[model samples]
Target: MTESSIEANYNRAKLEADKVDLLIAEALENGCSFLVEAGAGSGKTYSLNQAAAWVQENKWAEYRKNAQSAVCITYTNAAVEVIKERLPENSPVLPRTIHAFAWEAIKQYQSFLVKTVTENLDYMPDEGDFARVDEVRYTLGNRYRENGVQYLYHDDVLKLFCELLDNGKFRRMFADRYPLILIDEYQDSYGPIVEKFVEYFIEPGAAPQFGFFGDAWQTIYQSNKACGAISSDWLKVIRKGSNFRSAPRIVRLLNDIRPDLPQTSAIDGFEGEVVVITNDDYSGSRRNDRNFKGELPPDVLRERLDEVTGLIRGNVLPEETTKTLMITHKVLASQQGYDELLAIIGDALRDEEDVFLIFFKDVVEPVYRALCESDHAGLFEALGVKRYPINKKSDKIRWHELRRSLESARNSKAIDVVNAVVGSGLVPIPPKIEGWMSLYRGDSSTLYASSASIGQYLGLDYQQFVAAIEFLQPDASFSTEHGVKGEEYDNVVFAIGRGWNLYQFDVYAPMITGQVPIPSGKQASFERNRNLFYVCCSRPRKRLFFFVSIPLSLEFRSFLHDLAGEENCYTYGDFLREWPERTIAACVKNGAS
Candidate 1:
């Protein structure tokens, strides 16, 4: 990768963001619903801000007269800020998350909301359902109760609102409140809610004018299609053609991948390095062997990523300039030597009664991280000091001795750490772990992973167990492609294989590379994989590298060479040849503390 360093000159985009903003301004003037197909790094937010400002300036008088404020509906709070910041001071434009927007419509209809929650949904409260929304204590709403408190999931918000769309008066009242509605990142909008919005509002010429703004190629958040009937021809189509992120060559690769919505780079003459690394020769079996599964075995996969990352840091790009992006957290956990923890973690993580989870999260993790940082205050905090002081009152001098003992505990086995935590009499053991006293006494080796793996997991080395738990924490060294969405860097190390059930790159590669025709039945899935791949590829400003594990057919491999250029197509051996002399560099040092 040293040979593929980022280019020296970073010529900023020559194209004006005003081009799209002006188009959006004019589109709003026409008074028709429109969808802006803003591509990656096209400054879609800038366009949105500009459009909202235009609405505020030109339509404020009309909205004020009608007693309505235009609403900018987006998915995340961060996006709401992006739209809200650029609006005029005390502007009539109100930017809100879809959840907040739905809450506004349904909060006044308390009786109706309660009816929808109790009658339509399955989560019936144990003490009988709430009579009012104010009475219902909501952490998030879906389930009727959680931890003896009435609450729900986030999905419940959307579900309740979707149910309300069936009522003509609710739709009319919502339209009366908001004469203009703009949904940014509309592609990832909730499916059922967005569908009902189309049915009740957009399709039938409702009062509010609708504007959907997002790139279909960047809709990688969902496994299936996100924006449903919004793609229909009823809405006026607008394409923001300029890409202000990647260099000229990187844009060319993207254009080849997606010809339908081709991009014009803001850089007129800037060149970029595009390197593709593939392991076509490695022989490793999938844990569950099947033709559909493409990910290498966990250990083998770790080896592959480490070698590739080493080459990338020493040769291709420096650790400071490059960001490593994987497909999922599980994939990254495997690369970090902690994926084994993910198996037990996948099942009922919210179950408070699970002894393993309680021990890991509370006692082990907090103590482990505190010791690593050499913070005695943090250690004491984990021991439930301060507001909840150390329960077992021994000699106060013992706190000093415990620090040294706990620091050395990392060298002991995992079961030993658990026993020390429980036996030290420094902290009261949870009732759940006490209940499992019989299981803990048994030999871990005798317990099967399928039935009794908690003991077996506890039997691992404490160092390894702590490391696994740390990997489960948010690590900046490696990230999922989804995490880096709408983010750009000087260079990127994009590792592509398959870890998730739906992200089948093996099937998607041939379709994009022209080895086979795209199937109609798998069209949604193809788009899903393609959108993710495109999202990863288009993140780098000066240099882009793709390290793929799924062995591609010869024809598709050659197609990659042709697409990326022969000069940039790299083999695994090229990386291995230089590895013996170089030290591996981490993208980020990820000690959990």
Candidate 2:
């Protein structure tokens, strides 16, 4: 807390940042490939943007002389937009998702791909293959026609591009087209595909420079193995250790909890409060009882809500600034988890419908209704028909006449329907409609099945989606740990419980306190919970309160006391005893204010 201590922390953090800057400079100046293991709050995005800017400033002149542009690939569209906005207006950096980049390649090589596949393979064109590109479904086998061009499936487009990269000629051409390639969130990239890309493009020195930036510890997605598979030996690998987001106290808490990760420090010298409340008195006995299955009892859930309510009322400044984080590991296990969550959060909730519901409302129902009404104009308008040419020569065409002609031609297959709609030339194929066609191209039964009739089949998905959406609302006081990543608040009340399938506080307590190693079969569960807890705890800018469903072990309790100070650690009973009734009701009704 002293000025000297703050100065020391700031100096140490500066050294770490300088080290990262040096590594980036070395890679950019030497035209070498590099990978950075950026820890939480290490400013990974900033580093990536700097690298991109360096590429544009240093390597872009030569690349432009060769008619090529630098490429920056990221995992999410939002990230791409952010990076795009940060780069200079005339910068050569072309920010895109891996899929979007693959689509561009497919468009450029469509003719060549048509000739090569047709000449080299035994292609069978089915009725469904009418005018589509060779559909390369990764899970499904590749389908190509021996003669004509077809639209490429999303996965197939990536597959063909990877295959083309394997060819020496295509690899050189691609390298020439993209002299510098920087991948953000590289740890989340698909393993096999990235491996192939590295082998053909990076390792062979095909591209002038390459950069991969991401935090391996934050690899929460299932396909994380690919991140580890990337060869660290060939690239200049750097580990960035300073924390620029969280307070110093939070940084220290993360250090204790996730000591396995790279060492980190809070560069900003900000100090904040960390509170730990044990549920041992309430749920202690049931902690180790695996046989005790199902949702937590209502009394226990109510007690948790009461504790959160009290904290929000007393500790949260402006009360409305409180953010409560809960976890639902098995949202679809049963509706019980979501129901309990809703009941606990009460009125502080806002929900959004899932993608399927939105898609059904926006596209499917309209198209289906138009088809049934035999209104060609209505159908075309619903399809968002804009620039494609129509064959009728007349301003309007009767649906009955068109349907009769199509039926007489025996084009009744689902693919036939898609082709008629798409090939009609009256409407340009939109991405959403194309996606729908892809989903039911081979089987149209689902297309004709009305949403009303198929409600049962969609019931669970719809419920989960709505719950997730509500939990994610910015104005809502409550959210799931997974939903609150990358979000920060003045006060955060994190609830740890069992309904989330594997996230039992009893098991997590031991692992967190170093009293027990993560069990063999439960490594995945343990790591997930660890990451979730880390994310939730680090979200509070000023104060953090944890509410565990079960009691902490003696060792875990002592560990918490030491990490967050004895005054900050309390039993749930003690918390209730100290807080007044009105505060509790306020939290339960409208959140902690």
What local lDDT score does residue 386 receive in model 1, on the 0 to 100 scale? 65
Candidate 1: clashing pairs of residues: 1-315, 1-316, 2-315, 2-316, 140-152, 141-152, 141-153, 142-152, 142-153
Give the alpha carbon lDDT tens digit for every residue of 215-270 in model 1.
87788776433663266555788887777887778888888887877777775334
The lDDT leader among the candidates is 1
Badly placed stretches (over 4 Å) of model 1 are 1-16, 81-89, 114-139, 145-153, 222-225, 267-270, 281-288, 291-297, 316-321, 347-404, 418-457, 464-475, 481-483, 513-515, 578-593
Every candidate's lDDT: 0.69, 0.61
Query: For model 2, what is the C-alpha lDDT against the true structure?
Result: 0.61
Tens-place lDDT per residue, model 2, 400-445, is 4434444433223223434554554543465756665565555444
- TM-scores of all candidate predictions against the true structure: 0.77, 0.67
Give, for candidate 1, the lowest lDDT window spanning 10 residues: 584-593
Q: How accurate locally is residue 161 in candidate 2, as Cα lDDT from 0 to 100?
A: 69
